[model samples]
Target: MELDILAEKENVICEMVSNLYRTKSNDDSEIFTSIYNQYKSIHLQYSELSKNNLEALKRGLFIQWYQKTEPNFLSGISDLEQDAEKQIVNNLFTVINTKQVDSELIWMLNYYNSWDWVFLNYENFRRFDTNLVNEANNRLPENIDKKLMLKRGQMGKYWLSLIKYGSTE
Candidate 1:
């Protein structure tokens, strides 16, 4: 399947996970576990395929992790209770660290990781490290239009606010 289509599917699945997490009902744990296991199965299958497929899988996993690890959710769950979540993140880091990835994919992964980090460390953002931001800025494509750059800047600021203050609105 095309990467865009796969990305859309990933988004849908991640949204489902997010909704399950937000529900806070008694059955949420069972439902979340089922969905997460299915996601991991699909992720492992894609990881064994071509680089593009792996990238899509990583992107989807990262999006789900980002949503689930939001400050509000993380406050209630201990890392010891999230073995699967840790494993998924560790797998993503391992893949991104490999030498097999091309420069473009590396840049894209770095951008996504850094953007997600901003949210993952929302409470401690004041003391957050700048290395990821610096790396993302350095990897930015040259000669990009001012409009696109502005949009990216705006997004970063918006995400920062959402992390530090809560809510996108």
Candidate 2:
């Protein structure tokens, strides 16, 4: 996806994730609904993110935003059915929360190694290390003030002989 629109929605994504924690619902359905809404918003904004990920990129925005900012950012879901997607996300949250150290070797003994893997490969992604990302951030639209105009392109049409459409009138 082009970094421009993603950058535009960066704040939006952050707030959505933050809402997960802000949500105090203990009902599994409520929790699931919240997650589903957030997921849908992210997916809608980026329908082309990946072929299949919630298998992996299914968490496209989640993964990208988390990697750059913070991981295990929020896991507000709870009491979901055993087959709950929350369980999957919670586990993801756990693993992501543990990425504090700067060592890949720290995960040598880890099992169930394939979480959040998009079923297909993605291309043209923006990374935190790239200056283009900075430019994209800078290019986000800002709030603008609009003004009312008093006249039209024809200068209000005050013609002396223009009382009727036909000159013969």
Candidate 3:
């Protein structure tokens, strides 16, 4: 019974994580926010597991989730601090520096480098007091391509996240 419960919790966490990536890929901020909150709640439930399982499972989340088959736009989903985990962070830094990223991640890195564009409002322009970016009536730009811009506008957020969490936030 205990094993079954533990397995179920693991499955729930896995599904929640998949949902997070899906929402992020789709650029669905509303749904992503909802899933993010729910994941936090479900992860907290892992404490009910026996033994040192919670810490072990956290390691798995970082290893399988952040360091694997797909691009990890969700890099900071956990916190990686131990010496062994630092190796993973170093690997990512090397990949970024050497331009040797996996093909799947290349597009995301390109989009992020593009820095994307913004949709501002009258209040925003007034706040910045710059006529540089005029209001677009709170509408997306005509050339907006969400399909090609999944992580475009998140540079600062991710940069700070990588700095603080070291790629497993």
Candidate 4:
């Protein structure tokens, strides 16, 4: 009888943990066996106990759940992280293809590299006041606007592409 009760309790704990990742919050008791208040109290007890007795309860929340649950929850989380990283890498490749030598691309490159282009000239323009920019803007001719815009745009894209995809050929 005792063994049966322990098995049932273990099953309940496993179910609660499996549902934890699906639930909106860790405090939600819908996945737990006991009443909400009781579950909350026990949760608090566990948290406090873990904090006070670090040597015994040093394992993190995910580690604790993985240890108790029959399923490999750790692998699931790991796979999710890996898949997200892969998607980011794919998007990075798409950005790399944006650089080209067409007229429009040349214009973009010029716009980005201009001194007046804030993003492209961030190294020089960052922390500079609006007054300084306005002074520079007033002094510069209108045709230079296109050059600044294109230069800034190109430089911004170049640096961003470099950071995300590294030096591309």
Best lDDT goes to which candidate?
1
Per-model TM-score versus the true fold: 0.40, 0.25, 0.25, 0.19
Question: Model 3: how far is 150 from its true place, Å?
Answer: 29
Tens digit per residue, CA lDDT, model 2, 90-149: 433443445422222122112112232421122321222232223333321222111100
Instruction: Summarize candidate 3's per-residue lDDT along 45-159 as a digit string, tens digits.
Output: 3322212342323323233233233343353233222333433334434444555544334433333223222112112221211222123222222232332222221222323
Best by TM-score: 1
Measured by C-alpha RMSD in angstroms, how accurate is candidate 1? 9.6
For residues 60-131, could you state the per-residue lDDT of candidate 4 as single tens digits? 222222222323331121111222233322322233343212233233324333433322222222422333
Clashes of each: 0, 7, 4, 15
**Sorted on lDDT, highest at the top, how do the candidates line up?**
1, 3, 2, 4
List candidate 1 segments past 4 Å from native: 2-8, 51-103, 112-169
Spell out the clash pairs found in candidate 2: 53-56, 53-57, 53-58, 54-58, 56-116, 56-117, 56-118
Cα lDDT of model 1 by residue, 1-169, tens digit:
4544443444455557557567767766665555555555444444443344455444434434444455423221122223334444445445545644455445444555555553363332232234333454445343333332223221222234333333322
For residue 58, give model 4's deviation from the true position in Å. 21
Ranking by TM-score: 1, 3, 2, 4
Return the lDDT, model 1, position 60. 38
lDDT of 3: 0.35
